[model samples]
Target: MKSVTRSLRILEAVAQHQPVTVGELTKLFGLPKSTVQRTLVTLNEAGWLRANRKDTTRWEIGARVLAVRPAALQGSSLFAAAREPMIRLRDAVNETIHLSVPDALQCMVVVDRVDCTHAVRTFHAIGDTSPLHATATGRAVLAHLPQADVEELLERGLERFNEDTPTDAEQLRAELRKVRADGYSVNRNQYRPDVCAVAAAILDEAGTPLATVAVSMPDSRYDATRLPELGRLVAETAQEIAGRRDGA
Candidate 1:
């Protein structure tokens, strides 16, 4: 189990800082040179990571890591439609933007992200899950899902992530109501203590939410005074995506 944990950390580092050299990874983890290199080799052979062609000694996340990603997100109609709006939102807000799709359960998977240029920013790693009740994107997607789906998640139990994370099913339901009413959701240091995010859902013609687009920033830059304006920006971006047809 410890070995598996170490390998996952290495994979995370590779994902976080792609094209990272073995020496840099070893220093990043404060692990032995041999161990880091060994893990990198294993991950590469497993197809979860790949060596960078420009620098054979460095590595980047590989295709296999995206094997589980939703097909709609990969240069497909959904991707094409959402791309422009997501990029525009990122440029408009100057904050990290996330595009996520909800799972069958209580988590939402990040499908795309645009990082802020600021030195301080939150990185929502793609292909990773974030709890529904603790993330703005999560809540945005969840709010538009079938009521039975919401109930099923409540039955699965809401694991607390931080002080601001909503654990009570009733409370979360109330918030979902507000998300539906307002057409947006906001998380203030809910998932990560230092991060705040605002999100809006992108729905299909059937009125079902297919995904969410969110903007996140460090708490240091967050201002309660600006939430409404930022919320509007994110909601408008999501609406734009929702207008695109599946064949678009």
Candidate 2:
């Protein structure tokens, strides 16, 4: 029974400070390194936690947790508000639409998705996470965040996923400025190679970003000439979702 309780506490700590290291978790829980490592291994085996893709030494929440409590992760009202608009966006653009919320300034967590009919469309599991500096969905949320918060996130060191990823702080800051000015963000093979996307953030009454809505597709089907239209549609869908969420 004590072991179960300890494991549960460790899981909560991992979710709160995710992409965390075993050494860090041990220090946080005042447990021996061996004990913490054992618990993490147990959780990983149970599908409640997994090592970060970029840095295997760190851990993050797993898809099984999202699969088990989808409604809670979806934030009931936000899910309902985003559903129809996301569907409409996918139908309009014939690309997958994703709704993702910021996980602190660390990453964006995909909470919902409407898939396109294309056999080769881009895909992200509901619990998937991506860096704020490398994804259209992540940048859409990052662009609206406060300057201090953005700076703090930049200080964390952006991990490069592809040659096109903007790892320099100044370069990413400029891109965030563009996202703010254009009311949308575009990513081309930045996070995931050969995937392209356009996205806009859903803002609350205080103008704080609550989540982001993105239209994603494979580069093979992406048309540079359609960017303006795609950006407009994505931005409009984000606004519609925000309005519905507030009204709900």
Q: Please, what is the whole-model Cα lDDT of each candidate in the order they appear?
A: 0.84, 0.89
Give the runs in model 2 whose Cα sits over 4 Å from its true position.
9-69
| Cα-based lDDT at residue 7, candidate 2 | 94
Which TM-score value belongs to model 2?
0.78
- What is every candidate's alpha-carbon RMSD to the true fold? 11.8, 5.4
* Candidate 2 per-residue C-alpha lDDT over 1-248 given as tens digits, one digit per residue, 9 for 90 to 100: 99999999999999899889999998898999999999999899987888886688999987557555656856688889999999989899889999988766656878889999988889988878788899998899889989988888878889988789999999999999999999999999998988999999999999999989999999898899999999999999999999999999
In order of appearance, the predictions have TM-scores of 0.71, 0.78
The model with the greatest TM-score is 2
Residue range 87-199, candidate 1, lDDT tens digits: 88988989999888765453577888888799988887777777887889888888888898888788878888877889999999999999999889999888889988999
